[model samples]
Target: MNSKDLKILNLFKFDENLLISYSINLLKIIIILILIKIIISIGSSVIQRFFNKQKQSKFGFNEKKADTLSELLKSILRYVMYFIGIMWILEVLGLSIKTVIAVTSVAGVAVGLGAQNFIKDVISGFFILFEDQFAVGDYVEIDGLSGFVETVGLRVTKLRDFSGDLHIIPNGSIVRVTNKSRGNMRALVDITISYEEDIDKAINIIKDVNEKMKKEFKEIIEGPNVLGVTNFSDYGATIRVVAKTEAMKQWGVEMELRKRIKHALDENHIALPIPKRIIMNYKKGETNGN
Candidate 1:
């Protein structure tokens, strides 16, 4: 072999004691990693079991809320387990636990100064969970975006909007949340009839249709009563119909209500306001002057 190659080999010549030490450290790290994976698996199962139990218990949270909390806790547990494992691994590499902590603490402070937004997000996430502002299945409007809550994380909240787009929003930016899934919603429809049509007759026809609608739509919680003439448009008087419905079913109830009312009016010969075209009969095309 060349002289340079011999020198490189001599520098790395095996020391039995040093080799054994490093091998032990490497084995210890592997064991630590394996234990971490096992513990995380067990931790996740426990969290799921606990939440599932809560779902059955009347005293605990409902299914949606329980699921949300369960997922969130699992995420936190994973982070904690990984942190502890990393610290242990560092100690196994001949670094003093105390020295490592001291170093991380200093480094953490430096990172913290530049990561104020991250801190705010975590704090806000905690409040979101504790205050019960909204849950994973809730339909909510936040930051002018409306959607169903998909997942809630420590740093971000995901929303799946009606258009199927997923929005990942930072928790800290959520100052106001409008939850639409909490209580009953309103289904409102404004129907305009021709000025020639009797308002009282139209009102009665709508009320009759709504009576049958109550039986068909289980979503309706309260009256789909006609509120009488609310306004006068260029074509007719606007009659408002309003009903209380189960949350998230308002639009369905509204569309159905309109359809039924329209048919009912049509059957009773109650004309609705619509554009009418005047056709002039002539041998050929006629001009406005003609």
Candidate 2:
């Protein structure tokens, strides 16, 4: 072959080798991804099984607590596996993990300064997990945002309020947390009755309803004491009933109590608040209408 043809042939071989190398790296990437998926699945299953065994064993973990911890562990496991798998794939593609880490370490100094909030979030996440301040599925109020805890990640905590708005809060910003699903919660129901009705009769009727509700709802933990005539509002006399219930059951108990009380008041002929109008049209010192 001539010199020009020889050069063309050598270039073709070089391109061929490069294509083969890239193809092999692509295959390795696919394999690494599959392995990561398998590992994550197995890890999650193991974590779930461990927590389930704890529930069945003498471990102090209740079912909800077990489930909560299991999910958090699975989250951590997935993140770790994905990170390792990514580094492995990068190495397969001829990017040395050590070199990448070394460069990242140098760049990290600058990145870390700007990412102080990120570091804080991760540190706060560890404290949150260790201290057992709250868990997944707990209804908590964090930083004025109240909702059921959805996902507690190392960087963020998610909350979906009743209006269906998702709030993604950085863990570092969480200063105070009001976990409503921890201990017994208070169920308070305020009912308004007419001023003309006999206050004592209404009070007795409400007390009887409360006693019946205590039997009906096993969620009730303590007395639903009736605080008679708690307020005299524009609506009427507001009677308050307060009870202690199983955590997260307070709202349900309050709703049921309100509904039953409403029906009971109706059955007992207790007059509820009614709007009265006295229209006086004085023409030459005479009242015309009521």
Candidate 3:
């Protein structure tokens, strides 16, 4: 071998001490990884138990709120533990913690300037949770998208619509939220009766149906009484019935009310409106034709 090649070979020679040092560091890294996983699992379980306890307490913390807090806490904990584990691993691999932090600080300044939206999303998410604007399982409309909230994470919120489509929305973009599941909702139904039928008789029939429904459906909170003749169209006169129902139960109640109203009208011999048309016939020698 030439002199230059011999010198380069000597520089990279694998000595016993160097091999031992690398194997020790590798073993330490494996141990650190295993420990991180174990700790994270245990921490997650603890967080869940804490929330479950809160849910079972009589202090007025509902299941939905408890679930939301649990998920958020677990997420935060997992990320923190992973970050710590990575920093420790780097230190074990001969990089000092202070040096690593100094380098990251310089990079973080540049990243922070470019990631304003990310910061805004995280801040907005914190406010959403703290303010109790909406929780998981709540039917809400945000930025014109209506759905049941599935998750409220630091960066994004998940919504599942009636059609089973999942929407992932960034938290910063959710400036306004309309929550429909917060209180009672109104269930409205309109029925049309023929003008020829007695309006008084139709009203009585609807009242009877409403009385029976009030007893059957406990979700109905207020009257399903007919509001008299609301409008007159070419087809018929419209009668409106409205009821207050528990949140998320309005649609079911409205459907049931319509079905029962139809049956009641049929039983009482009240005729429902049907469209009709009149036709005029012209002879061959009509005035305009002639």
Candidate 4:
């Protein structure tokens, strides 16, 4: 062997203690990682069991509240475990945690600046849950995105609109929320008739239809009674029909009410005005001569 090659081999052989130390450190890290997995598994199981028991208890929270609490617990436990595991791993590698902390502090500032939106998203999501602004099954309009909430998460809110579009919205972006899932909703339809037709007779026909509708639909919370003479024009007077219905059923009730009213009016010979226009013309050559 050349002199340089022999020297290199001797140097490595002389540093056997360092090599062994590194090997030991790596082995410890692996063991720590395995223990972390075990700990996390046990923690997760315990959390689930505790919540499950609470769910079964008569005095405990309801299903929705229980589920939300369980999810929060799981998230916190995961972060705690991961943080401790990383710290232990660094310690086993003979690294200075104090120095690492300082470095992380600087890194954290940079990350925080870059990830403000993510922080806002998490904060907003927590407020939403805590305030009970909306739930997973709620029909809501958030920042103009109208849909049924499919999932509420720490960073994002998922919604599935009526058109079958799935929207993944950052909770931070939702400033104004309109929840349509709660309480009763209003359904109004304007029915127009010929100006020549008797308003009272048309109103009577609508009232009869409303009476039949009330009996048919248990969802109608209030009258589908006609509001007289909502508007007037050369075409006709617009007769307004209004009802209060259970949430999400407003559209359905409105549609059915419209159909029924139309049928009733047609059957009763109620006239609907049609827009008419008159055209008058003079011969161009004759007019010029005049």
Candidate 5:
């Protein structure tokens, strides 16, 4: 062989042992990844079992508390496992774990300096869970956005509104929250009648309908009784009917009250007020005439 050809062959020389070593490392990595998956799956099931046991025990943990804790624990477990997996993969690639930690510590400080809001969000999220501010399936109004809470994560909270829109809100931004699912809600239905109608008769009719509704809808907790004349408008005098209903049932009860009252009033021939307008016409040289 020529000298140049020999040099080229030397440069291209293959190390079979080195290749074998690398193949083995690759296989080990694959095995590690598979094991991580299996371990995580098993760990998740174990965590669920633990919580389920807690729920059934005399510990007095409600379903909401159990569910919330389960989600948070699962999330923390997944993150820890992924972090360990990443470190192991780095080691397989012949990287120094101590050196990686030192570098990451420095980088983490730098990131922490710039990510104050992220830290705040995480802290607020923890407080939200601990304080029982609200839970999944609760209807709440936060910063004027009202919806059912879907998930409360470490960094964000998700809400699904009535129209099926999902809103993702940062935890730190939820300053004021109005929880509507905590107690009974008020259902108010105002019935207006003409000035000429017998006010007592209308009130009695509404009371009758209210009595019937109380039997029909078990959600009604308190009276749908007439509050007497609540308002006098140009169109009519308003007789307000107020009822206290179970949380989330108020709207439905209010709608049903309106329908029944309307039917009752129509059957009794109680005239609902109609709008009236007075028009005036004036000639150029004369005063106004109606």
Candidate 6:
């Protein structure tokens, strides 16, 4: 009787119903994983298309903002897909979701504390994007580092300077930003002449040249006004020339203005100041008198 009962107990323990449930759960998990992959693929494609279309529209849309939104959408989609996939997998394995969530909450708090800087960077980056501080391809000075913005990520900003130097900066550390590409830039030039030269004539020549230059270079927004007698220094009387030019055109305009002024002075016979010294010739036989 004891041997028969033991054999029956072993058969019951290896029941067919248990095998069927296990196989069904395994199939369900596999199907869920496949479904998750399909959803992720389709969702990513849709997001990419929508954003790409937005970028191409003639709505005066900002390229950087479109790129940022696209990236954020992709990141969120990936995370959500994986999270649901994992939960479904756990459910198939007969695990309690409530316990998993409790543990994840504890771990999340710890992670939040450990990743405070990352969180701050993300928050600051959002603010920067929303505030329109700067964008890709814009020349800006941030935290004393000046460069063209290469990329604007959630945590860091990438910049490429004129010298080909690349700078990676945390968003939270960027306290102040100076965007040089936003508005008109000022062009300044200073000219000097000898004290012996006629000041009135020099100013007149300068004003004449500026008038002609304004007509020549349409980039000059306002008069390259010759502010006469700006300073009377030891070297000479400093005359100032100032003009406003379009952004990124200031440098070229300034250089051209300087060249024009130099050429004008030469043509007008304006004298440049020189350091002077006096020397006395001594007789060959003369000696020092004591």
Estimate TM-scores for all models.
0.78, 0.89, 0.81, 0.69, 0.81, 0.63
Model 4 per-residue lDDT tens digits across residues 179-222: 99789999999999998888899899899989999999999999
The residue-by-residue lDDT of candidate 3 on 1-290, one tens digit each, is 99999887776675656888999999999999999999989998998899899989999479989888887787678778889999999999888989999988899888985588888988998999999999988999999999998888877899999999999999998988999998999999999999999998899989999999999999999988788889999989999999999999999999999998999899888989877765445664434311
**lDDT (10s digit) by residue, model 6, range 1-290:** 69999999888888877898899998999999899999989998998788788889988356766766665566568778998999989878887899789878889888986578888987998888788888777789998999988777777888899899999999988998999978888889888888988989988988988899899988888888886788887768888989888777888988888888788888989977765644544766555432
Q: List candidate 4 stretches off by more than 4 Å.
A: 1-100, 284-290
Which candidate number would show the highest TM-score if scored against the true structure?
Answer: 2
Q: Write the per-residue lDDT of candidate 2 for residues 1-290, one digit (tens) a residue.
A: 89999999999999999999989989989999999999999888998889989889885587667866787787789879988997898788777878989988999888886579878988998888789888878899998999988877777788889999999998899999998898899999999999889989999999999999988889999978897778998768999999999999999999999999999999999989986666676666666443
Global lDDT of each candidate = 0.90, 0.87, 0.89, 0.85, 0.88, 0.83
Better of 1 and 5 by lDDT: 1
Ranking by lDDT: 1, 3, 5, 2, 4, 6
List per-candidate RMSD values in Å: 4.4, 2.4, 4.5, 5.9, 4.0, 8.3
Q: Against the correct fold, how does model 5 do in TM-score?
A: 0.81
Best by lDDT: 1
Q: Report how far off residue 45 is in candidate 2 (Å).
A: 1.7
Better of 5 and 6 by TM-score: 5
User: What's the lDDT for residue 32 in model 2?
Assistant: 92
Better of 4 and 6 by TM-score: 4
Q: Candidate 5: what lDDT?
A: 0.88
lDDT of 1 by residue, 1-290 (tens): 99999987776675666788899999999999999999999999999999999999989989889978987888788888999999999989878988998998889888985588888988999999999999889999997999999888877899999899999999999988999998999999999999999889899999999999998889899989988889998778999999999999999999999999999999999999886555665866763421
Rate residue 115 of model 5 by lDDT.
79
lDDT of 4: 0.85
